[model samples]
Target: MSLPPPALRALQGLGAVWTAPNTLIGVLGGLAGMLAGARPYWSRRDCALVFREYPWGPGGAITLGNVILHTGASLEIPCRTYAHQAGHCTEPVIGLHDHERAHVYQYLVLGPFYLPVYLLCGGVSARNPFERAADLYALHGHGWWPLKKR
Candidate 1:
């Protein structure tokens, strides 16, 4: 068989120069979202689920606290569904219970050690080992976890 493209091969590198910047930004945005959404009473099991279930996880869960400190604010989720179809509901659905629970979850997962690591190496490509792992988890949504037959 013919050889694979060089660009594709390079992408496998953790510190690959081409995709590092974008990956770094994604990591940052995820961390910021997590930090701004904290709650004290939330539990650890719940946090792990969020880190496991969502597209944003691992590093995203770790640096959340530091991002919260810099922003000096909280993450505001959309209270209403898109298209302004209905009034705001005070409670979230069960499947979505952990949807916006990033902040507290992040704190639980990494404790106080995540922020500095994020600051020092968040943008480095190799620092994102979990990115591929998370991607593998999400691939199930693309027909891997297809709906059941009636």
Candidate 2:
């Protein structure tokens, strides 16, 4: 049987994409929130409501519902609802500037390999080394945009 050229084959192979699981979703959201400059910082009570409503997904940390960080992205209480439900996550509901920026951070650090690896591994609970670095950057030092009040 005839076959495509080696170059064509390689390019086709490159086109194949691997999607992440729900577990790993948190990071994406967290990263987005960070970039948008809109973190929850909601009162503990509001946080609880968020948690009760959305519930925590995989590959992230959840405290009642106040905060959600997975991979590099996250969503805080109150605001998270908008981001989560609408798939947008804007201010009043959720700040998108930080979220988008955080995605950039994830792109930079995790690279293309991160998401594929995350999907292959299954479940987002495990904290990969790259994720740890981003988290550290977000927690301690001033990394990128939409700086959250500490």
Candidate 3:
């Protein structure tokens, strides 16, 4: 059976608490990015903090807990046009935000273990189960957990 609203909320609160350490790391990174001319905003849709024009990392974006640091003007795929060109994104137009939100959910579930497990799984590569799961979640809106059997 499904949990009631209060129970669900309590569990969510507990999750936030569990993930607070990772969130602190994200906040620190976001603060550093902010000092480098990045803009921070809250995405209610993704339920996470997003930093645009982030000046660090290789490029693209990175997700730490509930924070997403993007090196673009927006989290949308095209970042400019609303045109739905083929090969740009999935059917529902999921983008980096959706992918990063999956990481946030992962952090909520795994807490402090998320980073160690992610690195052990292969950092950031197609072979990484976590990245694959995040990609799956972005495309299909589910399957956020890595190594989860079908």
lDDT of 3 by residue, 1-150 (tens): 578989976876787789888888888999998998999999877767898999987777887877788888898772211122324443444577777888888888998999999999888776678877877788777887877774
In candidate 3, position 21 carries an lDDT of 89
Of 1 and 3, the candidate ranking higher by TM-score:
3
- Model 3, residue 63: C-alpha shift (Å): 1.1
Q: Write the per-residue lDDT of candidate 2 for residues 1-150, one digit (tens) a residue.
A: 345788644532333222123223543554454565424333332211111123334432342112334322433422232223444423233333233233334443334454665455442332333333333344443343223343
Q: Which candidate is the best by TM-score?
A: 3
1 against 2, candidate with superior TM-score:
2
lDDT of 1 at 66: 19
Go through the candidates in order and give each one's C-alpha lDDT: 0.30, 0.35, 0.78
Model 3 ranges off by over 4 Å: 1-7, 78-94
> Across residues 12-118, which tens digit of lDDT does each residue of candidate 1 receive?
34222333443354345645455656222223333221222223333223324212211222222222211122332333322122222332232333445434543
- Which runs of model 2 end up more than 4 angstroms from their true locations? 1-74, 77-104, 108-112, 119-123, 142-150
Better of 1 and 2 by lDDT: 2
Backbone clashes in each candidate structure, one number apiece? 2, 27, 0
